[model samples]
Target: MPSEIKLVNVPALGKTAGYSHLAEVRGGRTIYLSGQIAVDAQGQSVGTGDFTAQARQVFENLRLGLESVGLTFNAVVKLTVFLTDMQYLPQFRAVRDEFVNTAQPPASSLVQVAALVRPELLIEVEAIAAAP
Candidate 1:
């Protein structure tokens, strides 16, 4: 069955930048996760002051986030990443590659932001996933 797409809108903000208001997956009966941060299972920051390490931790957290909704990287159709510094792009991409198979890559976007939730966080990612 085809899943329906609705703009994702979290109550915290009336709107967001470059994201749907709220994404609703109907037929899929599955959840499409937003790219999560490098916070560990305990909700503690994983990568501090290191972009590469932070990037790796971010992907790991992404993996767990997807799993939380009964999905995996293979189910992801797109990903948007926000980084505090563009200079870390290459290194971050390398770390990201370890999680996704490139033969059929998901659509992706990377943007440099003035800052993240914390001063030490170098990157954050959000994603859209599909289910059978």
Candidate 2:
């Protein structure tokens, strides 16, 4: 993470298993990324009916998006994750951990939605990053 970014797991807010309770960024460019799904560069769906595979692809898309803006996962301060079913939380966390900074994880929100832009899509992720 950068010196301009601060991640906090507030004791008052209770313990967080894989995300921070709050993130503070000072004097940096804030980047907002659109939600990324399991579609590849060619717009082909990468995973069908596979939650783990779809989650990995979603994170990969996020990684690419971050790279495009000259940033990395460490620059991410917040994440908004949407899933078709909450039962896939564990799988989602496992894949997300592979890409994000575990030591200083970003503040995050997880939502269960009925559907996405594509019915085959199982997960979607959006991010907010700050760079010095």
- Estimated TM-score for each candidate: 0.75, 0.98
**Candidate that would win on lDDT:** 2
lDDT of 1 at 118: 77
Candidate 1 structure, TM-score to reference:
0.75
lDDT of 1 by residue, 26-127 (tens): 566444566678788788887687788888888887788788877777666678899888898789768878887554456567789998887778899987
Worst 10 residues of 2 by lDDT: 9-18
Give the lDDT of residue 67 in candidate 2.
94
Stretches of model 2 off by over 4 angstroms after superposition? none
Best by TM-score: 2
Off by over 4 Å in 1: 1-30
lDDT of each: 0.71, 0.93
